[model samples]
Target chain A: MGTNPVPNKKLAIFTATGCRACENAILDIHYQVSSLARCADIAFWPYMLGSEVRDLEKQESIDVCFFAGAIRTSSDREAALKLREKSRIMVACGACAAFGGMPGLVNISQWSVVSGQSQRTMDNKQQTNEEEKPELPPLESRVLGLPQIVKVDYLVPGCPPTQNFLWAAIQSLVCNGQSPARLSFAASRLPEAIAQAITSGILPPKGSIFAGEKAVCASCSRVKEEKRFETYKRPYQAYEELGRCLLEQGLVCQGITTQEGCGGLCTAMGQPCRGCFGKAEAIFDPGAKMVSAISSTFDSNDAQEIAALVDDIVDLVGTFYRYTLPTQCALFSTPSKD
Target chain B: MSDFEPKIIAFLCTWCAYVAADTAGIARYKQKPNVRVIRVLCSGMVDPNYVLKAFASGADAVLVGGCHPGDCHYISGNIKAMRRAPLLRKLLEEMGVENGRFRLEWIAASDAPQYAEIINQMSEEVRSLGPFSPSTIK
Candidate 1:
């Protein structure tokens, strides 16, 4: 993606508050990046290939912009609004941008999280006598999804989006929705759904999330057996065979409400669904739906038993609303026309 | 605070709390008449989003009243509510909502006087707590 940052149809990427895994996800598209690059230019990605602050300050309109972080600080909001102003199509690319992702957990408390980290940094600095790092810009009280701050045309929903699906999205956008005559070779290298999506060449309407409409369970290869919620298993604890569904084994799988389209990537690897792909279509509150789904599935109806079933759920908010919490303000805050 | 009347949105379970409120009305009980009730088939029917929506849409507070733990009409709907309430409360608190702004209680069908008393108490408590600004929600 960075090898030749020549100017063509302008494409820009902006990071506000994220781990930069999404940038790595784009890089993981490997050789396909060059083919996509042939169609467009990398206008202002400051992450890998360096760009001066003045270079971004003088930036003009862009064809497509991928914003990959939650709007945390005033600077982040300014960047988002600026990106919205300059881009023809703005995509929230990754869970942080689309639904607040890991960074949103800091909203648990405005002061404590940031202060705790800064305090730790102080301790580390004292130990090493290291040169002072640049201080971060002050955070807004809440983390916000891209859609909340400004209108977003599309969302690539994932902690870091699935590589093949991301490729398909870029290629489709580059081709202007028509399947390229030269896709069979690349399609053969992708997953079936991504291959079909690229080959079929139908552009979804604006504001569509680039993920499956159904829950991640639909794409998971694991067999669903009995839902015996006897105990909640922590990540460090031993788990059952990879063949069986992780949710049925009481591992806090969020597939029931999480949108698929990562091709069940984590679940396929025996990890439970963390709902990084935002709420599946038609679901309102991802956490509440998950609570209802799992609470009802417990083997025993006894109060103490149910509590026991949930006792191991250390971070209920993180487990269920890890990616969707920032989106919750839109879920119910506005009065519905009931 | 004397003139501050709280706007409460109650999601009452049809089997228990809804009927209790009806009986409170028929029995001529003295209650603070502030709550706008949306009767659900079961307490479990009220997703956390509904409570958030109620507060977001200008309500001062939200109360979710249902059957007692073992008395659920759906055998286990109230049990599910039990599991969700505390965590939902924590989530709301994280979003800058005060914990007292949400109340989860059990109201039996025959507990008309009790229902009236609870309503009066919640209304008075919220009135003292002052109006909740919806702008702080986001």
Candidate 2:
């Protein structure tokens, strides 16, 4: 038989510590690309060569790259660019890598705060101490995630995306001509048979879609319809009762529509899922998750009425989405006067 | 009076805090029984969430003891920790927790007495604040 050509490919995966999504992606990659795994190498953070991965402008030759952390600081962006340069294909692996994740939510507020502080410090210096300093005051900066900084190739959206996606992507790269097929679920929930097939090494057929959107309050079987309230009584207490949807059961959904996977972990626990799946497709303008949800819940025509209704859920949003709220979203609290 | 004991959680760097704590114990320094110490390789290894989780799970106070800025066993690890701690302190303040509830103290490996003082001061502050009720946690 004629000699079979071996695929020439190298892979390196970078991740942040304590990131479950990155950990999961690594595991999925192991299973999916087991056949040609030797071609790909993995590098965890800090262990990466050089003082800063981002400092290296042009990365050496490689085939695929996966960055699995929130690229908030300039250092992370530097690291990402290096990885993108080294690879023929690049992908931002988790929620943070994809659209800034929780860190992005802090960008607007953090910048303003830093700017305000620097301005105050400068004014104070100019008044109190006339000693010569730098010609211009130093500008303060905060971390902004990927997509905020660089042009990303592909985004696997998830607080952590599923392992299936990770492996599928890697396997597609190394297999060259043997791109594996991907299966899709109609609802967020994966079917038992499909789950088993995925676990058993049975490559899913391409173009498969699974459909089931049953986790949100709107999908809850226990809701009596008429019991659904327009606003929450006491937001924190709204997540306590099981066997009832939070919204339909007189509680706010806590941005459940934004997150996918976990079959609605918060809803199942009687709590709401804060939109941890990055941002939903249509709401790209800042604070889209809250804005869209608020609009959908009230009479869009009456801005005053909507604001009052939103105020009821404000505490809920703050408590449930604290780390994820960019100051911009906070400022976007009321309907715009203009 | 014993019931007024504070529940303190100390995150010590393996190279410095752990050694300093050991030195204090070996020197027979009397420390309050309330402080629970956790040893990590470097202060940089300590996640801000770990400190937050400690408070959420019932720590009356949290202490991060590391080497002096340039004295870090792992070079810039302590510096990064310094950067992280103050921000965490700010976050705690915003959440309405007493600002003194979280402390970042630099102690050399030989400074066992300094380590002892930190625990004593932290305990006193926590005790003065009284118990941390669930309602007190944001």
DockQ of each: 0.32, 0.01
Model 1 scores a TM of 0.83
- For all candidates in order, the CA lDDT equals 0.76, 0.55
Report the C-alpha lDDT of model 2 over A135-202, residue by residue, as the tens digit.
33243154344544555555555566655544544554444433324322211135344344454555
The segments of candidate 2 whose C-alpha lies over 4 angstroms from its true place after superposition are A1-8, A16-21, A28-39, A43-59, A110-112, A115-142, A173-227, A230-236, A239-243, A254-265, A284-312, A315-338, B1-138
Q: What CAPRI grade goes to candidate 2?
A: incorrect
Docking level of model 1: acceptable
TM-score of each: 0.83, 0.47
User: For candidate 1, what is the lDDT?
Assistant: 0.76
Error of 1 at A222 (Å): 2.6
Candidate 1 chain A has its poorest 10 consecutive residues by lDDT at A329-338
Task: Supply the TM-score of chain A against the true chain A for every candidate structure.
Answer: 0.83, 0.60
| Regions of candidate 1 where Cα sits further than 4 Å from its true position | A1-8, A57-60, A111-135, A175-179, A182-203, A305-311, A329-338, B68-76, B79-101, B133-138
